[model samples]
Target: MGEATHGLIDGARHAFVSPGVHWLALLLLCSAYLQGAFDKLRDFGGAVAEMRRFGLAPAAPWAVAVIGLELAASGLILSGWHRWLGALMLAAFTVAANFMAGRFWTAPKAQRGPMTNTFFEHWGLAGGFMLVAWHDLGGHLGV
Candidate 1:
């Protein structure tokens, strides 16, 4: 490759694999869920009602558990301690929650589009969590 091309590639590689970049990526990945957790905390009663709307019996307990998991995942990921475990936890939770709440296939025709979109969005977030876990486990893109 040309010298200029080689320099560009090296710079890109450094930028991509830097610790700052990793942290920023994790922050972006976790931002939505963190907001969700905060929202649940801010509106405990509303969260319980929403959980009941989702058909989770014992809605109050389920709301507490969900908020707890979200907070735990955020702490583990932000602290970079056992981040892989946190990522896995979030990924599993995302999948279960998506299926539980985003039942697009069974929804009425009018709601299918939005519900399906949400379901896929959650899956994408799950994939992002898995990628974060892989990186934490020492996988890299030749950086």
Candidate 2:
């Protein structure tokens, strides 16, 4: 092939290759998304109970609202629509999880442990999600 032809081919190859990285990143994000979604549905009652355990029973409706937000955020991520909004929702989830952890820390000892660990794990997942959102939106949308 001529020099110009080779250059065109190389550019095309790189263009195709770069999006593979983005898809892999999205896959990692989707995996985490699925896990978080499952946790919300699987332990619906326990999550509600944990709110009471953590003395947020007065805000039980708020707890349910958070679950709805999780589902909505996951849906947005899946649809690839309004992704920045999804990122904001995930960030909110992070804050809520951390707040839950703090509440558990001060609760009666017997109601701590496993729940605390789960909440902290959720917090970590949120951090990973922040990176994904940064990659998807911050890099792309500049917001």
Candidate 3:
């Protein structure tokens, strides 16, 4: 690449590596969990209904557990304290939730397409959480 091209690449890399940007990226990744937890807390009855819809027995307890996990895990992640643990918790949660909620394989043909997309999209997020955990565990490339 030309010098100017290299310079542009370097600049972009620097911007991406900034601490503030790193925090923002993590915040973006955990935003959904945070929002969901808060929403569940705000509407406890609705949360229990959701748990029942997902076929979780003793729906109220499941709802409470999910709300607690989401908040605690996301908090640990954002705070960068035991972040690896947080990432792993979120990763496992994502996969479990995906299976329970994103049953695209059994969907009607017309609904299959969108459901499949959402299902895979969530898998991708779970993978991202795994990567975050890996990096937090000192598996990152020299950055």
How much is 60 displaced in model 3, in angstroms?
A: 0.9
Ten-residue stretch with the least lDDT total in model 2: 25-34
**How many times do residue backbones clash in model 2?**
0
Clashing residue pairs, candidate 2?
Answer: none
Point to the candidate with the largest lDDT.
Answer: 3
Per-candidate alpha-carbon RMSD to the true structure = 1.7, 6.8, 1.3
The candidate with the higher TM-score, 1 or 3, is: 3
Stretches off by above 4 angstroms in model 2 are: 1-24, 30-33, 58-60, 102-143
Better of 2 and 3 by lDDT: 3
Clashing pairs in 1: none
**How would you encode candidate 3's per-residue C-alpha lDDT over 14-62 as one tens digit per residue?**
9888989989989999999999999999999999999999999999999
> Residue-wise lDDT of candidate 2 within 56-123, one digit each (tens)?
75656755776777678877766678766776687776777678555677778997887688777777
TM-score of each: 0.90, 0.55, 0.95
Q: How far out, in Å, is residue 134 in model 2?
A: 5.6
Order by lDDT, highest first? 3, 1, 2
Q: Which of 1 and 3 is ahead in lDDT?
A: 3
